[model samples]
Target: MLRTRIITALILAPIVIGILIYAPKPLMGLFFLLCATACLLETLSFMLPAFENRLAGKHVDTIVTKASGETHTKIFAPETRRPMLITVGLAWCMFLLMIFGGAEGAFGSLVAGILATIMVGCFLADDVQLGAARSISMVFSLAYSVLPWVAVWQIYLMAPHSRYILLVVIIVWCGDTGGYFGGRMLGGKVFGDRKLAPKISPKKTWEGAVCGLLLSIVV
Candidate 1:
């Protein structure tokens, strides 16, 4: 997995760097918009199944009995298409607003409007718990997948634009790469098997996190 990640990054780095360096502002914005859309879709896809399970009051794996009296565990498949499409469409609309309507008052107003719509819809749903779950999931997806790219787009519009973007990219890449390698190499050496978040990410050690932070700072 690490080797594949390295190889993929090597292949894509030049293309991404070239785009950042030479592409026009609109093209850059469009590129990031596509990225944001993909991220939003992925976020929704991941969370939708969890939301469905929560609404159904089922665990990640639920045991079901067949007519023949055989019991088997079933994993819920995400019913993500409708929600993903709608959320991605809204994300695109938000990007367009940023482009034409400007990223100041208009962007804020649109986000507010979206959130208000979500709240109203949730309020009117027959299942209040399900509606609440959907509201939380969608809000998180939008914030996580869309907001950072919007910030990056805004940064790209600043003076020394591409340079700023490149700096951000490099720092993030260095941190990620450093963390992976550091964790693999020296995970248990520094902290005596201490983990950063054992429940959430068992392999993530304090040592690796520190190394990544140091690498980011140096880079």
Candidate 2:
């Protein structure tokens, strides 16, 4: 896994640097927008099933008799594609608003509008409970996957331009690398096998987190 990560980084680093330094601002923004969309979709794909499971519990896996007298297991298969399409379309609209709206108030209003839309959608859905679950999952996925890229785009528009963006990216990369290596090498020794976030990330240790922070600061 480490070797794969290193090789992938080595291959993509130069291409990423080239784009960061030489690409036009609008082009870079668009690239990051696509990235954010992809990330959001991937996040939703991974999270929706888990969210449904939690919301439906044992009912999700219950067997039922159909009209044709066949037994079939009922699964919590929500409308995944439609929700994904709606979320992605709304995300694009948000990006466009960010680009042209300028005023922070306008952006805030747009966010409010989106939330209202989500609520309306929940009410209109055939299954209100499942719809609420899906809506919450979409919101979390958007925040987790898209907000940082939006921040990155905003930073890129700042005075120092790409240098600041590159600095942020390098710091993150260094931190991740440091955490991986530190955890592998000295995780249990310093922290007595304590985990940083055992529920969310079982492999992470306090020692690894400390090393990552130090590496980021140094870099």
Looking at candidate 1, what is the lDDT of residue 18? 89
Candidate 2 lDDT, 1-219, residue by residue in tens: 989998999999999988889899779878989998888777766555556557644133334456444333222234456666677777777766776665474468458646954774476356766777767777777778877777777788774449988999899998999999888899899879779998667889888888899999999
Clashing pairs in 2: none
* TM-score of candidate 2 to 2 decimals: 0.78
Q: How high a TM-score does candidate 1 get?
A: 0.78
- lDDT (CA) for every model shown? 0.73, 0.73
What does the lDDT read for residue 143 in candidate 2?
A: 76
Candidate 2: residue 206 Cα off by (Å): 2.2
Q: Which stretches of candidate 1 lie over 4 Å from their true place?
A: 1-6, 55-79, 116-125, 199-201
Per-residue alpha-carbon lDDT of candidate 1 for residues 75-169, written as tens digits (9 for 90 to 100): 22334454556667777877777766666755684667478537743753457676676666677778889888888887887755498999999
What's the lDDT for candidate 1?
0.73
Q: Looking at model 1, report the run of 10 residues with the lowest lDDT sum.
A: 70-79
Pairs that collide, model 1? none
Question: To one decimal, what is the Cα RMSD in angstroms of model 2 from the true structure?
Answer: 6.8
